[model samples]
Target: MANFNEDGLKKKLDDLNMSQQSIQTVSLWLIHHKKHAHTVVNVWYRELITATDSRKLTFMYLANDVIQNSKKKGPEYNKEFGSKLGKVFEHLGALRLDEKSLRGLNRLLNVWEDRSVFDADHIKLFKKNLNKGHGKSKENNSRKRELGGKHDNPQSKKRRDSASDAIQPSTPESRLRRDSEGDLTQFAVSPQSSTPPSDPPEPEQLIEAIQELENAATSDALVREKIANLPDEVSDVNLLNKLQDLAAGRALCDQVEEALSMLEAYNKRLAEEMEARKAVARMLHDYIAFQKDLLAQAEETLEEHRQKQGKVKKVREELKAHLQNLPDISKLPSIRMGGLAPLPSAGDLFT
Candidate 1:
């Protein structure tokens, strides 16, 4: 379980990863404390705002997981997260993000749209704020680039040109395009297929199934009543002595035999029903265990993917830094024709 307080929530957020297990574990803890949904969501948003850019997307994923999963249990999480999502999206849009992060955010938006996680108007507003932020960021970047082009010294310009030649220009759009083409490919092959486990019987179906056995071991009401009212001679040997004649004694013996046969049949049926109930119990146990195994496997896969994504991000950053420091080819001196010694004629060189 997780605490709903700001510091406790912040610590959880700090350790969060993009894994499904990580997201679900935190989501369940929050849902368990859903009485404080409003306070929890506020803390989540506050932590999200201060989180590193990479972790920001993870936080969004956590919110998405929680909102959807907690819907069946209660509306608290959904409502709380819904109210804050607009601000979250606006903040995200304002940041100049790499292509991957932007795509991840857009994908989450699309899911929300498709699932009707929030009202259309609210979703539309979130999108509006997101796009507005992106536009603002792009405008600022464009202005900066324009100013740099105008004011750069010759050496700086040459270095810029050399860097550009060494690697593609690092415009936001270019980076997005590059990431879309290259980096995103790494995520295409999942560590494991996400196909869900076979569903267990619905609660209603299980209830009905169990209910069917309520009278399984018993005879019908009329039969039970008749058996209960059986003549005492069937069980009491002393009643045999009170018989009026051989005919009466024979009649009593016949009744006793009929009763004995019915009891034996009823006993057999009870045994069969007992076996059936035990089988059902065993099946239910196995079904639950199977589902648990599937859940564990899925969690393991998510953890692997999260670790791999982290490594990829680290490598991408290292590459970017390395590209920035490439030598300036534009500053290389030109070889003038006058400075070069004349080449010997082919015949003289051969001689």
Candidate 2:
């Protein structure tokens, strides 16, 4: 059970070279065990579905294996397995597998390919489900390519070339910031003011662009068109060269995502450091306050002792004064007072 954890699954995947065969076995176990299935899915399936396009193929293969194996398990178990497998397909569709991939799945799952297999609703749902799942990324990528082409236009190139020779060529830091913003700025049509705009956009404009991009980078046609027009003027020569190699398509998005990811990590580290410093500062503050309180208490106690000593001294002085006030016994006259008793009792009685 413990081995079913993320690390264990990760290690297993790594060990198996991310084999679909292994995933099928594990996923089957996860599906059959009704109580723990959701836990396992919550732990790993979401991540698994988002795996790369290649890994997606592996998942599709895994589904085929489940279908083939279901025959031996009888109709009730077969029905259950089919239902669970359908759920997985839904996940894949949500992840947006392409039509080609889905068609490949059709062949692999023996759907339209095998006459022996009864056509189920699940099978019928495949194409519809994939189209629904295909969602926005595909469109965004298409728009990005279109925009990348227009970006290298003669007019834009002229402007860039003119700007390239301008003083204060972009520093690496500024370039990185621009690339970072690129992720957030989706396509938009530039305002048709005849006047030539500044080579580098104003900071506020860049911020506005980023906000627009973040909001509509998904499927907005207008935003897509605007993003498509953005010049690929990243100042890092090496990175620019790489972007060029990727046909300047989705690679830019990848780089932007990467940069943002790194930035997030850096920000997280800074926050943690700040929190640690705050904790230390708090401890020092408490310690200093405690020391001040101790000093204050000690002074108060010392004053109390001094007051007691003063009272004792006053008593001593009074006692000395009273003793000194006593009159001298030698100087005083000696006073006599009275009387003797008789001793001869027997003789007195006879008389």
Candidate 3:
């Protein structure tokens, strides 16, 4: 990725196109360096102002992609772009846009309004300014056409119209129009993976699994105690000296065999418990990763809420200040009964 500097950003903008891949690639890079969102937005606006009319819509699309997608990760891009979008709309609106360009711009505005990407008031103001600019441009074009028509010879005008019609079929703008229309269609359909995402493990299930591992080796306390207190005679041959007869020896042999069987059973249980522990370890690792992702998402949401609260607070304060500065309505002079001139009588009017 290129460094998030003004020069690097300008270079990227220069290469930007209407293709979904191009816009998304640039959006991802911008979102990655969201800490520099302020600089990025400034650079974007400056470049957009200088960009040709054909490229202006592409810049808007890039901004839209970044603002919408970056919200899940952080609000930096949205905040920065939100502040500058009004001016962006005004600039684009002032240009002589074709039908397709105007339609594309309207579509973008509708999407933002529907998504509530910005406050309703802001969106309304943006749309108003955009229309105002376009209206001004239309008026100017209308005046120019009227002025030109006054001096245009009928034969010359006909020839010029014919020439325009002949050349229109081969114009680059026509090709761009087709390509951009396709690109816009593609952009509208958000990309998704063919495979659906797997859900995280349930908290209850995870807790139960962990709890089961607590006594996985042996849940039988008595058996565990008995194993711990096993006699040494089971493994010691020297104890045979204490045997007084064949019956005693046989009894010792029986005790040793029982001990051996118990130890073997315990060993097998321990091996199974170890395997269970390994599986639980893997599960815990995945669960922890999933939890961290959730935590990050939550933090992003919290930041977005804080930004919204701050905006509302600021607006409220401004309104309060504006109200305070207004003159009191009650202190203004009031009209008295004789303040107005008397009306003429109906009889006088009839006479």
Candidate 4:
């Protein structure tokens, strides 16, 4: 969380001796891929750039700044054409962030960065990333410090001594006397004590410890047995009952393992049956589609036949009318009955 923001990055970038054209090319590329660049940097960009050479570091900062500032939409936005020209330094390879920077970029493809709208899957993934970033090593060291295994600072040591001096040792008689008074506040830190009271442990820390213990018990037989025997020392009835229940559950699980195997087989068979039914349903759907197509073709053929029949009937009617309109040869003329006079003899009749 150093001053790795845009201004700081740009200042670093200005220190590099890259050519203007190369820088402009890089800037244009970043501008073209601004969205992807933003997403890549937001999640996986390390705050620290560990480069041996100052030039390389400058280039990295340059690339980082260009990507970061691309999303600004106000007056301060980089409106200048060559504003991201420092990007050319990335070609040196040293300017590139680790390839692992791609890890969280894919997660942002469809995810809204706003925490409020996260679904269960998104929340789960966010928690996983959180756990990855703040891993068990930090928690382990914290626990070691809590258990007094870590070296204390001189000031803390003196404070602890002062607090210890303020507390009084209790004997059975003193305990009985205090019990008679029914007052427990007497053991509280005195107001005049120079040492400040330690802050109460966070609920999250307590929950993490409980989960670790539960996981240890489940994973290790020795730890499980130790937990089962814990009630002997604590002498808490509720704790004992819970331990008994846990043991009973473990025993029951072992007893039912064969049954679980049978159930698994049954489930597998059921899944297979369901898949088969789905396949059959798909085939049936295809068959129905094919039948529908055939029916459509048949209907089209029937329509064409009907059209052709109508055309044939029209033609027949026209022919019949034409035939009826024609004059009757018997009424029109009897060639043999003499519609004209006979021809005269060629020579004598003429004279």
Note the Cα lDDT for every prediction shown: 0.64, 0.45, 0.66, 0.38
Which candidate ranks first by lDDT, i.e. highest?
3
Cα-based TM-score, every candidate: 0.42, 0.27, 0.42, 0.23
- Please report how far candidate 4 places residue 302 from its true position, in Å: 2.9
- Could you give the candidate ranking by TM-score, starting with the highest? 1, 3, 2, 4
- Would you list the rank order by lDDT, best first? 3, 1, 2, 4
Q: What's the true lDDT of residue 171 in model 3?
A: 30
Task: Tell me the lDDT of candidate 3.
Answer: 0.66
Comparing 1 with 4 on TM-score, the higher-scoring candidate is: 1
User: How do the residues 2-35 of candidate 3 rate in per-residue lDDT, one tens digit apiece?
Assistant: 3457788888789888764556556656765677
Q: Which wins on lDDT, candidate 2 or candidate 4?
A: 2
Candidates 1 and 3: which is better by lDDT?
A: 3
lDDT of 1 by residue, 255-297 (tens): 9889999889877888988887876686576456545655785
Evaluated at residue 246, the lDDT of candidate 4 is: 75
lDDT of candidate 4 over 46-154, digit per residue (tens): 3223333434433433342343334342222232212322222222222323322221221221122221222456434533443344444543432223223226665
Off by over 4 Å in 3: 135-351
Residue pairs clashing in model 1 are none
